[model samples]
Target: MDVRLLEKEGFAGLFMRLRAEGLADKPLLAALEQTPRTLFVSAAHADAAYQDRLLPIDCGGFAESADLVARLLSLLSLEPGQRFLDVGTGSGFLAAVAARMVERVVTVDRYKTLVQLAQQRFAHLGIGNVIARQADGLKGMSGEGAFDRIIATCAFDSMPRAFVEQLASGGVMLAPILAEDGRARMARLTKIGSRFEREDLFEVPYRPFIPGLAAAL
Candidate 1:
């Protein structure tokens, strides 16, 4: 078999497991298959890109694992033509997937280097619908206005008010909520009128949400 085809099959098998585990559905799997995970990680970690695990990227952050990302996407209930907001862009893997599934994606990250790298990756993939920016994700992207779906890759002690306020009516937001015991639970919030209905999806492990922009790249 050709080397590239073999590698593609390996990644496909991982997505198959994700589907069997109920972490991904047909649309999500198709999107994952389309986006090359290796493009979103450092070249040194390219060999492990197909594994269902997080890989370190620029700055001190790590790219989220495929399973975790799939779970988040599943929670969003994304639809075509919807605008998506991705907080904590990291390596921009999630944002890239969102761009493929939705009409547009506005992703924000605290690290300038990650933002730049993500933009380059989006360009290389011919993904024009994704807008990458460097910002304090906890504050939310007020300038972009409301979004149909909002997803934060980091864990916060409590849901940020800005995220809640920026969600469009009937929109959904998913993030990991941290607790005093050092445990994090995946929470999904749906905006109904002016009120938000919250539901705990499951437990997850994620990096702490940092406030403000990073001082250095």
Candidate 2:
């Protein structure tokens, strides 16, 4: 990948677009500048790498929605050296970007083939701080609620109870929350004591949350 191309052209355009959309952020723009989105998926879609469009990947999944991905990452408000849990970790595109800013990323997907392919991509990229696993997204990652951040690429009819339970206090859960009318709304929820404060960020269209996944949320 031509790393300079992102800084020289891709990110420049991304910044302008984000600013016009009222979505600009320094950290996310930096991430967009540093991470080569083309490296995350098949060569067939390479031409569309920085076009701000979602592309198809394995397991009938679409790489994180382009604008949504950027905005979602920004909303997570990730800091350097933090740990992030990525549920529905698709092509590892978001995880790859996360690895650049965070200390480590624990990403899980329910699809075995996707996990294998994503792991291969991670290895090819020489990324060592990410653990990509094929596990039920609703089950949530175990261990002491130690993550500093958590985000799900998929959208759920309701917030997953497991995600809320596993979230560390003061940590945020970024997800697409499906409204009663079935429209997806981008949101960020912060765990506070035993309760969570959900904030709707924007409207979005996403692949539905996994089957039975909403029931548990």
Candidate 3:
């Protein structure tokens, strides 16, 4: 798909809608404008890349919509020179976006193929600040230590302690937490010294958070 056409006909409307809903800002919109969603998905889905919906990707994973990603990034309050951790990297879309806003991004996925694809995507985009790895996201990347911001693209029954521990003081994390009523709610956690304050952002549907590393390609 042509980049100009995608921006003019697709992303422009999406951004306008996000602005109307108070889910977008100047920096976030600029980052989304710079990153083409088409480059992150397979060619078959390229036409739908800019649409405000999730697109299925490899390993039964789904690329989140631009709106959701924008909202998550806005909530994270990312700043330049901050470190970021992206769980369930999927197509590396979120990581790529975060990399543009932060100094470094460490993105983890359980599927090897997904990680490989994410790495390739990062390279193709000339994104040097993102480190894509294949590992159990539930375990988190301890080696990376604390991060200024963390975001999970998948839904989990509960927030993992590892993720909480990896957040630097005053850091923020956004994830989809499954509630007792069988609904997933977008939750935000902020690490304040030794305590983590939780806030429910909104209700949204997302793929379940799978634990452990995948054995298959």
Best by TM-score: 3
Could you estimate the TM-score for every candidate? Answer: 0.93, 0.86, 0.94
**Candidate 1 ranges beyond 4 A from true positions:** 1-3
Q: Which ranges in model 3 have alpha carbons more than 4 Å from their true place? A: 1-3
List where candidate 2 sits over 4 angstroms from the true fold: 1-8, 22-24, 211-217
**Which residue pairs show collisions in model 2?**
160-217, 161-217
lDDT of each: 0.84, 0.77, 0.84
Error of 1 at 126 (Å): 0.1
Tens-place lDDT digits, model 3, residues 2-38: 7668656778877888989987468788888888888
Give the range where candidate 1 is weakest over 10 consecutive residues by summed lDDT: 1-10
For every candidate in turn, the CA RMSD to the true structure comes to: 1.8, 3.9, 1.5
Ranking of predictions according to TM-score? 3, 1, 2
lDDT of 1 by residue, 107-134 (tens): 9999999999999999999999999998
Residue 26 lDDT in model 2? 72
Each model's total of backbone clashes: 0, 2, 0
| Candidate 2: tens digits of C-alpha lDDT, residues 5-89 | 6436755666777888887677767766666676776778766666777788876778854556777888888888888999887
Point out the worst 10-residue segment of candidate 3 by lDDT: 1-10
